[model samples]
Target chain A: MPSPLRDLREQIIRAASVAGEGHIASAFSILDILWVLYHGILRHDPGNPSDPARDRFVLSKGHASLGIYGILAQRGFFPMDELKTFASSSGRLGGHPDSRKVPGVEASTGSLGHGMPMAAGMALGLKIRESASRVVCIVGDGECNEGAVWEAALLAAHHKLGNFTCVVDFNHSGDRALMLGDLAGKFRSFGWEVTEIDGHDHAQIEAVLKPHGGDVPRAVIANTIKGRGCTDMENNPAWHHKAPKADELEAVLAQLT
Target chain B: MRRQFVTTMERQLDEDPRTVILLGDIGVFAFRNAFKKHPKRIINIGILEQATVSVAAGLAKEGFIPLFHSIAPFVVERAFEQIKVDFGYQALGGHFVTVGGSYDYAALGCSHHCPGDVGLMQAVPGMQIIVPGHPAEFDALMTQTFASGKPAYHRLSERSNREARCVTFGKAEVVQSGGGPVIVTVGPFLDRVIEAAGGSDATILYYTTLAPFDAETLRQHAGDGRILCVEPFYEGTLAASITSALRGKRIALSSMGVPRKFLTDYGHASYHDAACGLMATDIRARLDELSHV
Candidate 1:
C-alpha cells in the first residue's frame, strides 16, 4: 500500500541527515498529513504561492519545520535540492515556519499557541470576501495548552466555518512534555466535531479528510510519534532539536532507504 | 480619549474598506454606529479580552488594519501573550488602543486600576507604544499609527485632561516653562504638573510617544537642571527609557508613579492621585527632596 509519497518520508529525513540539521522527528511525524494536503487536497498553483483562490495550510505548530518544507519541495513548490538547507543560516528554513520567506507558507509561526487564531481569522476573512479557499491549520497536541487555541476553536465552531479544518499532530510531546493528549474529547468540549486516527497511515488520514457532519469546524486528532521514521529517533525527545551527527545521518538514511 | 479613538476608527472605516475595528465587549458605545455604516468592519467579541486580541491579530494577518480597543488593565494585562505571539512574532497590522492608562478607574477597584500597562507590553519585539497626552494629540497619534503598517499600542488615559497646546507624535508638550528644573510628564495627567510647577521655577513637558521618543529630543530639554519625571502610568519603563537616554549627563533624575504592588485601599480621587504622587504637589515635594539629596 505504501507508494512513492510514502517513500518521501525517508527522503526528507535523508536531507536533514545529510546536513545533520532540522527537527527531523517532528517533521517525520506529520509527513502523511502534509503529503495528503499538498498532493491531493490543496487547490493550489505552485507558480503562485499568493494565488488568491488557493487554500491555506497554516503550520500553527510550526516547530515541525521539516514536514512542511519537505512537502513544498516534493510538490515542486521549490527545488527538491533546496531542502538541503534545512536549519542552516542563510536558508529560508527557520527553526519555525516563516511565511514571509517561505513561498507557500501563509504565516510565520514558531511561538506556541498563535497559529490557529490567525488561521481562523483567515478563514473568516475568506468568508467575508466570499472566497471558497479552505484553510487547514496544523496544530500540535501539546501546543493546545495555550488558551487562545480554545478561544479560536470556539470562534470557528460558533461561526459554523466548514471551510476551516484543524488537524492536531497528537505526538504527545510539546517542547517540554505531553500536552493534553485527549484530542477528541477536548475538541468535543470546545464544540468541534472530532476525528481520531493513526497519523502515519495514509488511508486512515484520507478517510477522515472530508468535511464534518454539520457546518461546525472539525478537528482531526492524528495520533503520531514524536520522531516517527528513523529507528534511532522514534519517540526520542532528545531528537526534538537538531544535532544529528554525520555518521548518525548515514545510519538514519541507510535505515530509511 | 476613548471617544476620540472610536470616532477616528469610524472615519477610517468609511475612508478605507480595509479597516476593521474590534471592541472587546468594553467599547460598544464607540462602534455602535460603525456597525450600521460597515457591519462587516466592526466586531464586538464579548468579554473574552484575550480572544479579542487574537481575533484582531487574525484580521490583521490578512491585510486588514484592526483597531483593538479595551480598557488599559484588561487589554494589555490579560492578553499580553496574544499580543506578543500573534502580532509581535509575525509583524501584523494590529493596533492595540488601551483606553484608561493610569488610575482611570480608581473607583472600579484594584483589578482595574494599577499603572504599568504599557511597560509590560513595550519590550515585546515589533510592538510600538504610544501614550496620548491630550485630546488633540490623540487624533494626530491615531492617524499616524494607522498609516504605518506595523504593530502599535496606543495607551490613552481616562481622565479629561485640562487642554494644553496640541501635541504631535514623538513631540512632548512643554506645559510650564522654567530653566532651573524640568519635569517631564506623560499621559493626560500633566494637569498635576501644570498646577504644581506653574508658579515655580520648573519646566513641565507632556511626552507624546513612549517608545520611539527621540531620546535626543528629551535630552536637549533636560540639562543644567533637576530632571524630575512624572509618569502617571507604570514608572519602570516609561521613566526608565527616558532616564536611560539621559545617562552620563549632569541632569539629576527622579521618577514617580504607582508602586509595583496593586494598591488595595479605595479612596477619594485626591487620595489616589496624591498617594501615587501623580498629583503636582506630591511631584513638587519629590523634587524638593531630591534637591536636598
Candidate 2:
C-alpha cells in the first residue's frame, strides 16, 4: 500500500475511535477512489473551494464521509486536526457530509439516491452555460435499491449529460438485504457508458475518472472490498459501522502497515 | 393558470439568463414556444419527481434559478423529501410550481390528489408556499418570489377568482374589513369566502403567499379573537401560523378545507368541493356558526 494511503487509513481509524461512531468499513471501501479523484481527477482548489469552474463531486453514499473528510483534510481543504472532531457536535464534519459546513462537499447528502440526480443537474447546468466543468457522484450498491437512483440514471441519460459520471462503490454491503444484480448492465441499458474497475487500484480509478467525450453519461462500477486494508475487517459486514477500541485500533493499524 | 405560468416563465426566461424551467412531462405542450426560444433553459424532465427536484436543487447549487413544474401530488407530495432535504436542508433556492392543487385532479383518484401539499411544504422550514387564486396573481407572485433565493412552492389551480387583487409576497390583502370574526381564505377560495361572508360583518383576508404567513395582517385584523380559515388545501394547514401569530391572545380558530382523509369517490373538482363542504353555502354556515360563538 502507498504510504499516504496507509496513513489515511490510520487517520480514519483514529478519528472514528475518538468520535466513537462512523461507518468505518464503508469509508475503507471508497477511500482509494476518493483519494484518486481528489488528488488527480477533480479540478478543485482548497484555497478557493467555491471556484465557479471547479468540477463538482457529490458523495451520494454519504455514510463514507470519513473517507472524503480525511482526503479533504489531507488535500488542505481544512486542517488535518479537524478530523479529531469527526461526528462531534463542535465539528463541521458529521457522519454524513454537509455541503453547507464542509468546504469541498458540493451536495449535503446522507439520504441514498440523491447525489447522482444533483450531479446530473449540475452537469446539465454547466452544459447549458457552455462551461468545461464536470460533475462526479458516488453511490453505494445499497443506494441502488432506492428508486431515485434509477430515476437519476434515466434522467442523466435522457439529458445526455456527457460531463456527468456516477461511480458505484460495489462493496456488496447491500447484498444481505437485496442483491443489486447486474449493475453495469443496468447502467448500460439506461444509456450510460459503463466502466467496471477495481476501486482499490489507483491506476484503474484514474484511467476512467477523466471526461469521456460522448453525449451519454458515464457509470463506473468500482468493485471494492468493505474494508480493503485491514484483514479482520475486509469484506466483513460486522465492521460496517464499528469503530475500533484501543486494543482493536492497535491491531487495525498494524494490518494497515 | 398553467397558461399564465407558461407566459410568466417565458417572460422570465427572456428577461433572466439564469431562469431554467424543468417540466415533469406534464406541461410540455404549453411551454412549446418557450422551448423553441430557449431550448436549453426549458427542459421537459421526465416524470421522475424525486430526481427532478434533486436536479433542481443541483441547478440551484450551480447558481441557476430552477423552476420545477408538475402535478401537485407528484412534485409536492411524492417528491417532498427531495424538496425538504435537497432544497430546504441544503438551503438552496428553487421554485416548485405545481398544478392540480388539492383535489383539482379529483377524478384521477387519490394517487393524483395532494390536499396535503401546502401542509407538507409548511413543515419544511424556510419553504415559501404561494397559493395564487388567479392567473394574474400567479404571475405577480411567481414574478416576485421565484428568484428570492429561497425554496418556494407555487400551487397553481385551474380555478381562478373573478378578479385579480394586487398581491405581494408575505403580505395578505384585506379584501373587506369588519368588526366581526376574521375569515381567512387563500388562493381561489377568496371568491367563495367573499360570497359566503356576503352581507355579514366578517373581515376577509386573502393570502396569495401562505408561508412567511402574513401574521402581521392577521393579528391586526383578527378582532374579537374569532378566526376561521377557509383554505383550498387540507384543513388547518395554517393553524400553526395563526396560533403562533397571536400566541398570548385567546383566539377561537376553526378551519374548513379538504378533509385529511382520502377521497375514494372519484369526481370532478367541483363535485369534490361540494362533497367536502367547500361551497359558499357551507362556508357561509361555518362563518355564521363562528359569528354566533
Candidate 3:
C-alpha cells in the first residue's frame, strides 16, 4: 500500500485530469502540510465539520484548492466520488473553493491574501470566547506580495493571538522571480514565532504544526518544490496551473506509487 | 453624529456580547469611551482596511456581529474584493460603518473624497447601503442594522438636515406634503432638496437606505411621474433602482448629484457641491426645467 501522502497525490492527479484543468503543481506543494494537519494535528471530527470546538483550517492560497478538496474528501468531510466532477458546472466545486458551496471550507478564497486576515479574525474570536480551538492558515509564497498579508501579520502579533498559526508554502513558483529575502526574519520582525522546515518531511511538518499556547502567533516556512511528488514537474513554473495530459498523468501516478 | 454613533455602540457593547467594533485606526478618539469600556470588543486594527474587513467577516462567521469602521474611500474601495468574497460570498453577516461621504474632507484632496462608494457598493450583490440624513437617523439606522443580523453598509456624512423623521430601512419618509413634481432626497441632501422645493407644491420623499429601494412606496407617492432624484454620491446612483421601481410608468426624471468628473479644486465640500450643481439653487433650477418639460 502507498503512503498517505502518495495516496493523496494520486487522488489530486485523478481530480485534475477529470477536471481537465487545475493548479495541480500548486496543490502538490502544500499536500504534506494539509495531510499532517488533517490527519494528525487538527482537532476536528469528520462527522461534525461545524463543531464549535474543532480546530479551523483556511487555505489562504486558494487557487491550489484541489489539495484541500482531496484532504476534505479523504478525511470524510464529503464523498470521495465528488472529486471526479470538480471544475464542472454540474459539480459543486469550482476552480477556487467557495465556502458556501463546499463542506468544511471555512471561507471562500481565490483572490490572494484574503485568508490570513480571516484566520486571524477567527483566532481572535476564539480567544474572546476562550475556546481551545486553534486556526491554521496556509498561504503561497507568491501570494505574500499582497499588502493585506502584512497587515494581518501585524494585527495577529499586536493582539497576541497564540491560537493562530500561518504556514507559507515556499515553492518559488510565482509568475515572477521569488525575490522575498529572509522570509523568516520578516515574520520575526512582525513578532511571530518563526520556524523553518523541510515541507515534505512529515515529522518536521508535524513538529512545527503542534500547537503551543503562547502570546505571539506562529509562522512556519515550509520549504517545498512546486510540483512536489513528480520529479520532472518539481520546481517547474510551467506546471503552475496546467493540467497534465493522460500519458503524463499515468507517469506521475506510477511515480507516486 | 459621531457622538451618536459612539453612544449607540457603547449601548450595543453593553447589551450584546456578540457586538465587536473593528476600526482601521481612524476613529481612535471619536470612539474612545466605547473602546475603553470594551477594549477587546472595540478593536483598532491599525491602518489596515483590507484586514479590518476580512477580520469582520471572520468574526461574523464565528457568530459575532462586527462593525468595521473606516473612511469611505479606504473602507469601501480599498478592500472591496474582501467585502465581496469574504462577506458576500460567504454570506457572512456584519456592518460596514463608513464616514467621509463624497467630499466631506474635500480640502484634503481626492483620496479623502469618495463620491463613488455608493455606486461601488451597489455592485456587490446582497449589500444593504444606508446613507443616513442626520444624527437622529444615524442613531436609528445603526441600531436597526446591528439588530437586523445581515450585511449592511452605513455611509455617514458630516452634513445634517434640520428636519428629522423616523428613519427605517428600505422605506422613504415623506418630509413635505405637495402636489407637483416629486423630489426624492437621499442622505443629508434632504435639507437641500427641501430648500430647493422652496414652497413649491412638489412632493418631497427622503430616503436613508438606497438598497431594497421602496419602489412601491415611490410609485404611490410619485404617481405623476415627474421625479427629481437628489443624492449625495455620484450622479444617478439610485437611477437604475428608481427606474426599476417606477418601470412601466411614463416618468419624467432628472437626477442631480456630484458629477463623474474629478474636481481638481480643493475647497469646502459645499464648494464641490456648488461646482457640481448639487446644492439647493441648482436643484431648484433643474426642478423648474423638469416642470416645464
Tell me how far the alpha carbon of residue B66 in candidate 2 is from the true structure, in angstroms, after superposition: 0.7
**Whose DockQ is greatest here?**
2
Backbone clashes in model 3, listed as residue pairs: none
Among all windows of ten consecutive residues in candidate 2 chain B, which has the lowest summed lDDT? B98-107
lDDT: the better of candidates 1 and 3: 3
Better of 1 and 2 by TM-score: 2
Q: Write the per-residue lDDT of candidate 3 for residues B18-79, one digit (tens) a residue.
A: 99998778878988888768888988787889988998888888889999888999988899
lDDT of each: 0.76, 0.91, 0.88
Give the chain B TM-score for each candidate: 0.91, 0.98, 0.97
Per residue, candidate 2 scores C-alpha lDDT tens digits across A1-257 of 46998899889999999989999889889999999998879999999999997999999999999999999999999999899999999999999999999999999999888888888889989989888999998999999999999998988888889999999999998999998889999999999899999999999999999877778899999999999887888998788898988777787788884
Question: Best lDDT goes to which candidate?
Answer: 2
TM-scores, all candidates, are 0.90, 0.98, 0.97
Off by over 4 Å in 2: none
Error of 3 at B61 (Å): 1.4
The C-alpha local distance difference test score for the whole of candidate 1 amounts to: 0.76
Encode model 3's per-residue lDDT on A153-234: one tens digit a residue: 9999999999999999998765476588899999999999999999989999999999899889999999998888877668
Listed for every candidate in order, the interface RMSD values in angstroms are 1.7, 0.6, 0.7
